[model samples]
Target: SAAKKTRTMTTQSSLKDAFSSYADDLNHLNDKREKVVKASRDITANSKKVIFQVHRISKSNKEEVLEKAHKDLAAVVDQYVARLVKELRGSDFWKLRRAYSPGIQEYVEAATLCRFCKSGTLLNLEEMNASLSSLSDPSHKPLQINILDYILGLADLTGELMRLAIGRISDGELEYAQKICTFVREIHRELTLLVPRMDEPYDMKTKMETMLQSVMKIENACFGVHVRKSEYNPLLGSGDPSYPLMGVAGGIDL
Candidate 1:
């Protein structure tokens, strides 16, 4: 009887130890995820600031607006993005993507906006990640932005581009407005084909709807410009004579 009791106690003790260890591990993981969530919030807030800064750019003060935006973006990477990079590990990058994605997307919006304003080119995802690479430790695999985040960010960028196009048109920069129309139209068309291939089609679908609206807004703005230009051409006969109707043609196709 005593030998049987000793074996029973030993089994109970082993189970207790195992459960305690499991509980501790779960607690640790929960804490880690909480840190990631908080970091994500920080990144989201700071990244929005960067986006706002970039939106301040105008044709006249391009250099000054971008300079300020660049500084704000750098600060965001240093302060908030770095925290995200530190907390996230290999699988955690994808696992916690939803938590951090808004921030990352906002960052992408800002970076690409600045690039477009400065050079009339999209900032590729590779370049955005390359810029982020320095924030992570060299020994650890750098935190690279995945394609999904990049794509989502790009979707949001169309909205900003729409705003920029409207502003440019009001500023009498018709050519710039046309360029934005062309760029947003291309993005909308490409995303229409790409959305179904994405992992979760719902969010992309919603964004695609919004993106279509952005495209329309730019198109309408450009169309208005073209119409005004055409109507005034004969009356004034003094403005630039080479205004092309290419932008209106693209809008009609949409």
Candidate 2:
């Protein structure tokens, strides 16, 4: 009976030790997740600043505005996104994707916006990931922004472009607004085909609805500009799309 009691106590002791280690492991995981969340918040905040900076682009300051935007975006990558990369390196980022996904999406939005503004072209996902390759060590798998996040960010970009289109139309840059309208329309059409295949189709479905609204906004702005231009010169049949609007009835309202 004495030997049996000793063995029972030893088994109980082992169980306690095992449970204690489990608790420690859980606590460590929670701490790491919290750190990644905090880093994500920083990345999101700085990426937004870059977006706002890009919005400062104008017909005259294209080069200067894009130069500053590029610099600001690079700062976001080096300062805030680097922290996220460090925390997620070697680990399966998919596991913590929910925590960092918002920031990644925002970063994609800012970077793509800057790229599009600099050159009227879409920044492909592979190219975006390639840009980040320099930030990672060769030994560990680099943290790549997954397709879902990239698509979500692209969806958000249309809204900004819509705003830019309205402003460009108001500024008498009807041709620029039309260009933006065409670009956004193409993006929405392509995204419609791709969204169905994305991992989280439900979330992307919501974005696609919002993207449709953005597409309409740009289309409306361009349409309004053409209508106004036509009205101003009844005989010219829409007149010169690129002609400065200041010549059209003291600048038409968008």
Candidate 3:
């Protein structure tokens, strides 16, 4: 047991040494881009914080948290897009642009969960007194999201890894996620650009619907999203219309 303990400690120390060495290099390389990438991964917690903050904000100002996150992620994503575009200087530049497109849709869709929850229309809630409709009482709010949470966890981690891999490119092995970030950022920037124009009528819902429709088609075409309905509705009551999602296990609206 004592020898086992020593071995465990040695392994831990070795891992620490390896991480320390990599971090030092990451901190020093290419204007500390690796550190920035790591920092981005660390900010995943901020998404949860923002989501909860939205719920808190809902109680106070009747403000939509999902909208707030959409605005926030959109703004930061825009800032990063500019930075990312600056990174793509060679033949591979277009790939970076191509990658961010999926991200743009993801963030937009991710915001919807918070939006629907704040609006008391959380459709995935399993124990709601009534179906998704205009509610007269707070008790009607449902919170069934076992499946949704599981899917988002995977996507978020996968995307975070992609971000770090992108950040580390040139300093390390080439990472395709950087290009992915660029593509996503471009889409976010384009979507947000429409906000300030003030000339368009109320088309955001329509636009998002259109975007989701397009996304579904693309995923179906790519074979990235699959359809597998259970015999019974897991969250909502048995319904004619069911939400089809990506991932083999299925995902939330995010």
**Cα lDDT for residue 76, candidate 3:** 37
Task: Pick the winner on TM-score between candidates 2 and 3.
Answer: 2
Worst 10-residue lDDT window, candidate 2: 242-251
Best model per lDDT: 2
User: RMSD, model 2, all Cα superposed?
Assistant: 3.0
lDDT of 3 by residue, 1-254 (tens): 99999999999999999999998866655444433343333333344444444434322244554567557644534444223333322223222322333332243233443443344232232332122122222433321223323233323323332333333232222222233344334433445455444233244434534444433333343332113334334445667444333222234534
- What does the lDDT come to for candidate 2? 0.84
lDDT of 1 by residue, 50-125 (tens): 7787777666777898888888888888888888888885445776777777778877887888788878888998
C-alpha positional error of residue 186 in candidate 1 after TM-score superposition, expressed in Å: 1.3
lDDT of each: 0.83, 0.84, 0.38
User: What TM-score does candidate 1 get on C-alpha atoms?
Assistant: 0.89
Tens-digit lDDT track of model 2 for 20-107: 9999988977888898999999999999998888788777777998899899899988888888998887677889999999999999
Query: Where does candidate 3 stray beyond 4 Å?
Result: 1-36, 42-49, 57-60, 64-67, 81-112, 115-254
TM-score of each: 0.89, 0.90, 0.25
